[model samples]
Target: MKKYLVVLVSMLGSLSMMGQTNTWVNDPAHSRLGFVVKHLTISEISGRFADFSVKVTTSKPDYLDAQIEVTAKIASMDTGVEMRDNHLRSADFFDAEKYPTLTFKSTSVEKTGKDKGKLHGNLTFHGITKPVVVDVVYFGTVTNPMNNATTAGFQIKGVVKRSDFDLGPKFPEAVISNDVQIIADVEFSPNK
Candidate 1:
């Protein structure tokens, strides 16, 4: 009976250890936050967050049990044009005052296909938090010579109205769109 008990205990311990997971850190050198905004009535402008991180972990290879957290610095906003960038950081747009960080935390992972999934998470910005769903496309992994890291890429895209976050409606005379599309092209490196 004692030998049987020992075997049972060992089996349970192995299962517990099996639950341990692996993670991948953001390779800042290869990762970036790129976005676009509408201007006037016919033009579109591009910008990016120079600094950000995507912290991810999982026990499965398909990233089925994976979880992710993202944080971007508001002050890193850049639109190529210096003056326009400064104004965006001011009280009119992002108001770099009351809100300084843009964050996202995943709630669940749903498989759409063999290489794709849907991530439903909460996005917090401009002092407002909303449930945002991102269509996630996994671009596989590769060994990078420039950074000497195994990087996995993802194209996380979604649309949310600026007004929903209390960013205010367009000026009575200003020409801009209400809905904002965000493309978070991010990469991650392995961690354990």
Candidate 2:
């Protein structure tokens, strides 16, 4: 009976230490929200937003039951050249002044393969909210040496029609494709 009691106590102690599913904060230094798009139908141009935030709450190491919210500042666009970045922020494209932020909210997390799944979320861009399914591939986790925080994130891929959200009307006359690819990588550390 004593041995059984010790086993039960140990089990409860283990569970008690696990306050909740891996609650992580966004580690901006090691995380980024990047995007790709066809530039003039000649090549793919990649850009990243320097300002963003994310909060993740799911950690089976291979799965997530997370509610993620990302807010990207329009002025943080970087596309290798200052002129192009300014244009992208203008009314011809993102219209950074009027719509200063883009957002995403996860609705459900579905498990799929050995270490991948689909995160269905409502993505709001240019004031149009649409249900977007992002192919989420988990990249595992590690302890940050600098902060001593456990960190993890996933690569999310999705496509959105630029016209659907009234993003860029001028692009229709040029080689700018209607479909734009959005890729996001989120790295979160513990809220503590």
lDDT of 2 at 130: 86
RMSD per model, one decimal: 5.0, 2.4
TM-score of each: 0.83, 0.87
Candidate 2 residue spans exceeding 4 A from truth: 1-7, 16-22, 59-63
Over 78-117, each residue of candidate 1 has an lDDT whose tens digit, in order, gives 8899998888777777887779999989988899987788
28-124: candidate 2 lDDT, tens digit per residue:
8877888887867788888999998887666454556677777889899898899999999998888899889888888988988876888898888
Choose the strongest candidate by TM-score.
2
How many clashes in each candidate? 0, 2
All candidates' lDDT scores?
A: 0.82, 0.80
